[model samples]
Structure formats: structure tokens, C-alpha cells
Target: MNIDIVCVGRIKERYLTDAIAEYSKRLSRYCKLDIIEVADEKTPEHASAGVDRQIKAKEGERIAKHLKDGAFVIALAINGKQLSSEELAAKINDLGLRGTSHIQLVIGGSIGLDEAVLKRADYKLSFSKMTFPHQLMRVILLEQIYRAYKINAHEPYHK
Candidate 1:
């Protein structure tokens, strides 16, 4: 499967980048993983909440454009379903069986994702109820994906 992580904002921290890259390399043994970073929308000091939401929506649109046609879209949201590593692997395998060749994972900015993007997602996933920084979330998501692959293969990493 070809999995793409579409996230907002560039990872500025070298450590975070290195960690994400390491997991990406590890994931290559299972499937193709691509991480795409979209520019975060800037909100002015006097911007209203509605304006801020619109900015986020525009950013979401940019991310959505990269999604392949018929790709399974999964959005990361606070109110989404939480799955264990084993369950995630099962889900991935199920998708593969369903003939889904591409999986797009969307990660929003601090303000969260636009409603349109959420509505477009085939699945909505939440890592935790407590919010995390976008950069940290990227690392966590990648690690989980790698763990899921390990669990699917009955590898020792999941133990």
C-alpha cells in the first residue's frame, strides 16, 4: 500500500525530523510511506474565529489536493476513534483486502481540521484526548504505523 501523511506545518526541529524519517525508513519494509507537509495558514491578530477557521479550511484544501483519487482518507481528530496497534494493523490489512491501494492520513494544525476535510475522511482517528503539538503528533503517528506493521508481521517490536 502507498500511505501518505498529509500534515500542516514543516517540522522545524531536527530531532523530530530525524525521528520521523527513521520510522519512515522502517515502514518501507511494509509499505510505501510519504510525508507531505502543507503550509500553515497565518491568522492576523485581529482575526475573528470565523476567519481563523476559513484559513484552516484553505490549508485543508491544499492538503486534500494531494490525495489520490479513490484513496482512503483518514483524518486525525480529537473526537475520533482510538485503536490499539494490533487493531490498526488489522484495519490496514482489511483495507488492503478491500483493494485500497492508497491511504491518506491528514493531520491538522493547532486550531484543528476544517469540517469539510473531516467529512471527506473514510476514517477519523484520535491518538489521545489530550492535545499534542503538531510536530510531536507526526512522530507519534509514524511510530504507531511502524508498530502496527510489526504487529501485523508478528514481529518482536510489538511485544
Candidate 2:
């Protein structure tokens, strides 16, 4: 299976960059994992709701650029479906056997995803209802993906 994580903003912190690299390496044994970091939109302090929507739209456009044809799109959102590690592993396994050749997971910018982008998703996943920094979320996402693979393989690492 081929997986792509498309998100806004680069990982500026050394620790986060290192952690992401580690997960990426681990995931490589299971499938092709691609990380695409788009430049974050600038949000001025005290910005209006309209301005915020525009910012998200711009970021959405950039995220859309990395999407592959006929790929299954999964968006990470606060209100999305929350699944356990086992369930996520099952989902990944089922998807892998399905017709799709690629699975694209989207992590939106700080303000969240544009409705237009969310509408394109085949599945919306949420690890938690609580908020998290975009930078840290990337690391958490990668870890979960790696864990899911282990679970699917019935490897000792999952337990």
C-alpha cells in the first residue's frame, strides 16, 4: 500500500522532525509512506472569520496538489470518526485489499480544514476531540500509522 500524509507547515522543532523521521523509517517496512508539508497560511492576529476561511481555502488548494488520482482520501478532523488502534489496523488492512492504490491522509492547518477539502474525503478520522498543535499532530499521526501496521501484522510491537 502507498500512503501519503499531506499537511500544512513544516516541522521547525528538531525533536518533532526527528520523531517523524523515525516513524517514517519504521513505516517503510510495511508500505510506501510519503510526507508532504505545505507552507502554512499566514493568519493575522484578530483576523475575521472570512479571512480565516480564505486562509484555509488557500492551504486546501496547496494540499490538493499532492493528491493522486483515484486515491482514497482521509481527513483528520476533530469531529471525525474516532477508532482504536485495532480498528485502525483493520481499516488499513481492508483498504489495502480494496481496489484503491493509494490512501491519502490529510492534516489541515491550525484553523482546521476548508469545507471544500473535507467534502472530498472518503473517511474523516479523529484521534481525539481535543485540539493539538499541527506540528505535534504529524508526529502522533505517524506513530499511529506505524502502530496500525504492527497490529495488522500481529507483531509483538502492537501489544
Candidate 3:
């Protein structure tokens, strides 16, 4: 499987970066994982709805550009469906069985994803209803993907 993570903004913290790298290395046994970081637009000092929309639009364009052709796109959003680890493993295996080998997981910036990106998604997934820092979400996502792989293989990690 080929997994691509298109995320807005870079991971500035060393600890987070290290953790992500660890997960990425661990994931190599299961699939090819690539993480693409896009530039995040600066929020205006006094922003309005229009400004926020414009920012999301710019970020969305950048995010969409990195999407792989024929890949199943999964956008992370607050209102997305919540699934258990076992369910996620099942979904991943099912996608592969159905011949959708490439999977693109998108993580938006602080303000969230635009409507266009959401519309293009094959599925919307939510880790939690509570808010998390975008940078931290990257690591969390990688860990989950790794966990899914373990579960699919009937490894002990899922327990």
C-alpha cells in the first residue's frame, strides 16, 4: 500500500518530529508512507469569516495539489465519522482488497479544511470531537496507521 499524508504547516517541535519519524520508520514494514507539508497562510490580526474562508481556500488548493491520482482520499475533520482501531484496520484492508492501493490522508491547518477538499474526500475520519494541535495530529495519525497495520497482521500492538 502507498500512503500519503498531506498536512498544512510543518512540525516545529523536535519531540513531535522525532515521534513522527519513529512511526514512519515503523510503518515501512507495512507500506510506503510519504508526508507532504504545505505552507500555512498567516492569520490576520483581526480576521473575519471571509478572511478565514480565503485562508482555507489557499490551504485547500495546496493540499489538493499533492493528492495522488486514483488514490482513496481521507480527510480529517471534526465532524467526520469516528471508528475504532479494529474498524480502521478493516477499512484499510478492505480498500486494498477492492484495489484501492493508494490512500491519501489529509490534515488541515489550525482553522480547518475547506469545503472543496471535503467534497473530494473518499471518506472523512475524525480522531476525536475534541480539538488537537495540528502538529500533534500528524504524529497521532501515523501511530494509528501503524496500529492498523498491526491489527491487520494480528500482531499484539492492537491490544
Candidate of highest TM-score: 3
In Å, residue 122's CA in model 3 sits off its true spot by: 0.7
Report lDDT (CA) for all predictions: 0.91, 0.92, 0.95
Candidate 1, lDDT over the whole model: 0.91
* Residue 89 lDDT, candidate 2, scale 0-100: 91
- For residue 37, model 1's alpha carbon misses the true position, in angstroms, by 1.2
Question: Would you list the clashing residue pairs of candidate 2?
Answer: none
Instruction: Judge candidate 2 against the unseen true structure and give its global Cα lDDT, from 0 to 1.
Output: 0.92
TM-scores, in order shown?
A: 0.95, 0.97, 0.98
Identify the leading candidate in terms of lDDT: 3
Model 1 C-alpha lDDT per residue in residues 10-59, reported as the tens digit of each score: 99899998999899999999999889989998768888889988998899
Tens digit per residue, CA lDDT, model 2, 1-159? 899999999888999999999999999999999998898998999999999999999999998888776899999999999999999998999998886679999999989998988998999999899999999999999999999999998898986
Tell me which residue pairs clash in candidate 3: none
Off by over 4 Å in 3: none
lDDT of 3 at 10: 88
Residue ranges of candidate 2 with Cα displaced over 4 Å:
none
Q: What TM-score does structure 3 among the candidates reach? A: 0.98
Clashes of each: 0, 0, 0
